[model samples]
Target: MIPAQFDYVAPGTVADAVAALIDGGEDAKVLAGGQSLIPVLRLRLSYPSLLVDLRKIDELRGVREDGAELVIGAMTRHADVISDPLVRQHAALLAEAAATVADPAVRHRGTFGGSLAHADPAGDLPAVAVALGAQLVAEGPGGRRSIAAADFFQDYLQTALAPDEVLVEVRLPKLQGRWGVAYEKFSRTAQAWAIVGVAAAVRRDNGAIAEARIGLTNMGSTPVRAGAVEAALAGASAEAGTIAEAAAHAADGTHAPSDLSGGSDYREHLARVLTRRAVTTAAGL
Candidate 1:
């Protein structure tokens, strides 16, 4: 498959890119890693009049610590995220989840912000972002603004980023104390999209679970927080039985889909089982 004719520009500056996007209007599309958009273009699913490339923008590529938060530039590669010591040390769940995105080649080419902006519910990063309560930074004609992870994804293949906006960076809160984290992904094969994925970050206090944050992938139209499971786990014993009992509520508020991998009911069941594993592992129980 081949894409239709389109004008392309690789802007060296964020302002220039935004200007191009504003000029191109509704027919313009921004190109980041191209892992998702290229496929769409080749299939002729989208025919943008202009494509704004952001790869050469130096400011949009790196990982650094800002006060208590770790700021990751939008253009940082998944491979970089996996290897960056700052990310590995401060936000282990993100690194662990990024490692599961496609295979090595995709990880090498895919950008962190690209995946989040693509807003694919099955994508590994979105659930992790939601789980970690990450903040997405977007720059548009109106300067800049931050969107909370819980409010970023609007629906399947949709996000809260406006058409004129480009996601610039992601701010992740540092894990404070006694925190254990794990990502549990269930796929038909290695590198395949997860049928059901769970990202868990649990804080332990004494011999019980102090607080737990759980994010679900492919459980709804968007990556969703497992609020029911989290509520059930608060102050619960770290025993396997207690964790398993709480994990049974993983699907309590989700609206999973029926796809080739499994039926909706099957996904709900996997959510329960995987949630237990993720929570238990993250709790170090």
Candidate 2:
């Protein structure tokens, strides 16, 4: 289906983009890679009167390091993310997850901010973002504000972005210690959205888990941290038995949906199973 007619403006700077967004008001929508928004437009799920294209905003591209943080511009493509040597070495979980985002074609055009802003429960980027304790930087006419990953996602398909703001970049803290990270996804076929996905980071000290962060995808309305598992993994063995015991609470406090791909109970089971496997893989067990 064809999309509703809309005025288009390509902003040259972040300030211009925010001004356009505010001027366009609620009837305007920001355009990133267009991989997600274009479909919504074509399906008439969104009918914004104006489209603010962010492709030319130079400030919204590339990656840089600031002290202990790795700042990734919102417009950075998933493909770039996966291949970036810096990201691979320091933020391997993100690189791994991006490599699995709907194959190469989609990743080539989809922006990291677009995926996270879209807030799709099954989207790989958001899960990785949450797991890494990333921070989103949003700029508006009012000024810039930094939002933590835990506070950015509000509900299914909902985020905390204000109408006049544009997400500029995501800030991730540098991985510390002898950390092992893994991204595990379960899909029916290549390019299929994950039925269940897990992103795990484990820090080992003397072969014992010093710290762990696990994020579950497609297991809730928003990507959720496996706190129970993290708590259980602390001071515990990184062996299979212990991992399984902690991962038992993987589905706790999640509002996972049942769909044709799987049912509620099935998703819960997957959450547990995948979390265990991902943590194990990260531990190199």
Candidate 3:
């Protein structure tokens, strides 16, 4: 299937990209890696009048450290994210999750920001981002603004980014204490989207669980924070039994969707099961 014809522009800078998007109006679509959008275009799911390509913007393609956080450019490839020393050291959970995204070929072409901006609930990275409390940065005619990962994703396949705003980078705070992080996912196949996934980070103090963060994938319209489980684990024992008890609350707030892959109840069950495994591993129990 051939996509409908559209005007195209490769912007050298974010400013130019915003201008191009503004000029193209609501009919303009930003092209990052084109891993997601091109397929939509080919299937005629979207018919934009213009395509604003950001590949020419070199500044939006690297990882760097800024004080206490690691700043990842929006255009950084998944493969790069997985191998970047800075990402591996400061945000290993992100690298671990990136390793499970599709295969090597897609990893080389899929952009980090593009995946988050796509906001697929089943995507591994969004759940990691939410679990890490990462910040998403965007640029538009209104200048720049920072959005928390919790607020950045609004719904399935939807984000807080305005049509004219281009995601610039993501800021992940370096884990400061004795924190162990893990991502666990269940899919039909290696390349298939996760039916249920869990991202867990646990900080242990004196053999007790001081704090925990858990994010759910494919559990709701947006990546869901397991706040109930987090609260349950706070100041609790870092033992398998305690972690399993907290994991039981994984489905407490989720609105799991029923699809061809599995039913909502089945996903909820997977959530509890995977949460136990992920949290146990993260807790080093």
- TM-score for all models, in order of appearance: 0.98, 0.98, 0.98
- List of clashing residue pairs for candidate 3: none
Pairs with backbone N, CA or C atoms under 3 Å apart (clashes), candidate 2: none
lDDT (Cα, tens digit) per residue for candidate 3, span 1-285:
999999999989999999999999999989999888998999999999999999999999999999999999999999999999999888989998999998999998999999999998999999999999999999999999999999999998999999999999999999888989899999998788999999999999999999999999999999989999999999999898898899999999789999999999999999999999999999887
Instruction: Output the lDDT of residue 143, model 3.
Output: 99
Write the residue-wise lDDT of candidate 1 on 54-164 in tens digits. Answer: 998999999999999999999999999999999988999999999999999989999999999999989999999999999999999999999999999999999999889
What is the Cα-based lDDT of residue 179 in candidate 3?
A: 89
In angstroms, how far off is 135's CA in candidate 1? 0.9
lDDT of each: 0.95, 0.91, 0.95
- Candidate 2 vs 3: which has more lDDT: 3
